[model samples]
Target: MLAALVLLLLTFALLLWPVAVTGGIASSLSYCLSALVPSLFPFMVLCGFAVESSAALWLSRPLGFCARYLFRLPDCCAAPVLMGLIGGYPAGARGTSLLLEKGRITEKEARRMLMFCVNPGLAFTVTYLGIGVFGSPALGLRLFLSVTLSAVVLGVLSGLFSPLPSPDKPGAERMESRPGALTRSVEGAARSVLLMCAFLLLFSGLSALLHEAGIFQGAVRLLSRLGVFTPNQWAAMLSFLLEVTGGTGDARALGIGPGFFAFGLAFGGVCVHLQVLAMFRKPPIRPPLFLLCRLAHGLLSAGAFALMGVISPMENASTAPVMAGIYRPELSGGWRGGASLALMCAAFLLMVPGETGKSSLRAPGPKLISVAGVKFPLQNR
Candidate 1:
């Protein structure tokens, strides 16, 4: 808590320094709010509710079964891991935390789950990268396949390396059957979505403030000159470190051939890494393992993208304009930005409170359940 507080304070102090010294407070504030409000607001509201009630629930059972049988993880962790893949990092982390608190999963299992749980989804790939940024669904498809396949391979490998405790292990306990699976699932999903939305909004605002103050540009320039990256590559790198949306936007702005852009996008930016790190907090996972997994993913993604760049056929000229058109940002009149902010605020309010009133629903009433013909105590409501 203290560390988080200090970080927040430092962030604010940095943002305020320029305004305090130059007396550009109003302009800085305006730029910060405007830049953040449009993209961050609606995303919080729409994605927040949709992710919890719809995506998280839909994926949980299948994910649980896979984790239990394939990975040998405790039954409790399946839903969260699945949620992580479908709902993204925040959702996954939140789900893991909830499961941990409920005593459904041990710390070791939670940490292991975190290793493979931090990633965006196919929808994000198709919508944001393919249609929104790349202007070609085909490019998006290839990039999505590359990233997804890499994640799957890495996830499986990590699971193999980090073997779960066997049932005979000293601390191994039998799984409990929960009664309000439906309700708990809904509550858990909602909480996960709300938390993610909050992070997105807060970070988006921070990102906007930095961008408006020209800090982002300076950082990009510094990073670009440090290595083999070109100016545009530097931008993409910085954006990835800062935010996925920003990184993807930078990649689109490069105006490079689809092949180069695809590589950059696949390699991902720093922001994705940071988001993954942020998700680790809830599970209290070991930082080294998480970092190692990300490093592996990065290397693999870079390799895949590079190969695609070399072998993929050039996009047709006729499609270029269409792609460009899709990637172009529309300049919204002032009113639209304000409307977006309003919508975001509304969404935040709607999703943040749904968990407060719900009672802690216990698992199905205490009864021994058999797994692999071995019976164990069950804690039920």
Candidate 2:
């Protein structure tokens, strides 16, 4: 009820604000809603449901195998990794929350999993942002490497700070298989995807209102004056805070240079983080640790961008050929090859489990309903 009231109040304010009305807020709001509700939201929900039901079980094994062998985390951690990689940020958080609810992962493990679980997919990062928006396939590769590396580093650091029990530990138990688990997984995925999409649309519209009111632009201007950021950097930061696509769009419009673009991509949009946190809230996951991870990501991405800037010429020249080499075949307006490759990679990741023999499983049951018609489920497995 509090959340609903807040949304109502926010919407009322946006509607009444003259500046928000004048700055194309209405149009942007319409566009955002249309994209999310009828298209993106449904797709995401269905995808989540499908993945959780069918793909998760198969994927958990390999993820469990990998995490146990490489990171020493139990099999439970694998679910979040799989969900995050396939379903995007919220999926990861939802998965983590589910694991926590089931007592599959300890609080410390949940915190650490939340830290590095939210990430955009390779297809979205590479195809949409890199090719569609930035017009540089090469930029996509660099951004991919940057974000992936950042996740790995942060994941490791998070583990270091709050280590999970070793496989040999007495409390560490292998995940057990259950009957009809696939169906339950699907339902949980569906619920999570729907909740996430609703919040995403709401926030996406709010972001549009802010943009129209010049609130976002003003914020960018203020940050740019801090001396460390270029106009592009400021725009990227604003977008990151406000919305990922918007920030990336702003960066593309600036056309500052490859260095700045790389920086923006690596940093991700602040709005993306907000959207991610919003999704996690639905599952009632802890937010502070996720925020910490975002902060760390921003810092690391900035440092990486700075380092790239120092050797800008060499990095640019060397990266060009590599980008060309990887994407050369797709230049003829064929996305199938790239799409296929991404699907294959996703499949491989989904299939692999961490070392823990236990499968990270979400229990099958109806979500609890309150007097206000709110249905609360424990977690997304």
Candidate 3:
């Protein structure tokens, strides 16, 4: 009743700020057009194709060892973990949901995996933050490594808390190919990208309304009075906390360091959180758990970034260069970026054992249908 009343009141207030709301929505749409659609859409399509084509299983073979031994998770988890690390944001969540939808994993496993499998993409962290924001690709690489470390730590810790069930054999013995996989992948990616944009626009408008109402300014003033940060710092932090994209310029502008940006990347802003939530029809993880994990991730990333800063100062760090073409800021957000990850996954695919060389291990769950040379899982009625 209270929540409903509050929402109703907020809705009433939003109607009063027509120009601000419209401007925010327009800016968000521009961002989607220039940044989100161009960078994320292609990567999402690739991720969807990887899962739908069952190439994920083959690609998971190398990471399977780490998933099983280090994380103490089922082998099927490697694919989603990879997706989260490489594809970024909701990609990992998307992969987990796919496995759940296919009945390859239980809801409990999906929930646990989601704790660490949602992350910022390497391109965004390295390219946008490193080069675009800081003018130092080395810093971006360090930030990416920091976020990855935190996720790895969380994955290991989650395993300790919620151990997998015994007799957890691999999800499938062989890849299940589908001729329609590409088309389905493209369609699914379209839906997911649209949903993400919807959430982004919604949050952008809400943030504008809040700004017009002086809510953010009031909070900043209150916090500044308590000496948490200066009014400017609080304002900048609040902006970055609510929406990472708009405020993710130079952290030094607000007298902050890379640590703040690192935290934002891991925490992923409220907008990114909503985008992730919208990916699932029914979210497997509770909101509290999701928030807790993100908080931990942010803290860990900040700490990692700080540690790296102390150990390797930026002046000295630039001497050690990353991949020339791949990590370059311009290429990292486009088709080449997605292609690089796909190629890497393909390279790993070579390590997987062929059908004749593999031992048969199966789990009972969904029925499979074979058409021509392709296999598809029958949807549950």
Identify the candidate with maximal lDDT: 3
TM-scores across all candidates? 0.59, 0.63, 0.77
The runs of at least 3 residues in candidate 1 whose Cα sits more than 4 Å from the true structure, single-residue gaps closed, are 1-72, 75-79, 164-179, 256-282, 308-381
Q: Candidate 2 versus the native: TM-score?
A: 0.63
State the lDDT at 245 in candidate 2. Answer: 51
State the weakest 10-residue window (summed lDDT) of model 2: 372-381
lDDT of each: 0.52, 0.54, 0.73
Error of 1 at 305 (Å): 3.0
Q: Report clash pairs, candidate 3.
A: none
Task: List where candidate 2 sits over 4 angstroms from the true fold.
Answer: 1-13, 17-65, 82-87, 161-179, 256-286, 305-381
Per residue, candidate 2 scores C-alpha lDDT tens digits across 1-381 of 999998897777677765534343444455445543343333354434433344445555666676665455676566567546544555566666666665666666666666666666666666665666555666665666566667777777666644445543322332343455556666665665566554445555666566545566567567666778665556545655555555554445444444544444444455455555554434344556555567677667656655654665332322111233454455444687677778878877666665775334433453331212222221100
Provide the clash count, candidate 3: 0
Residue 134 error for model 1, in Å? 1.9
> Model 3 over residues 1-381: C-alpha lDDT tens digits?
999999997888778888778777897888788877777777777777767776766766777778777777766667777878877798888778877887767788888788888788888888866776666877888989999999999988888866654433444524455688889878888898898888888878877776667686677667777776656556657767787775463134444566677888888888888778777789898888898999899999989888887887666333122344545676576798899879978866775558777423333554443322223332210
Model 3, which residues run further than 4 Å from truth? 1-4, 161-176, 249-255, 315-381
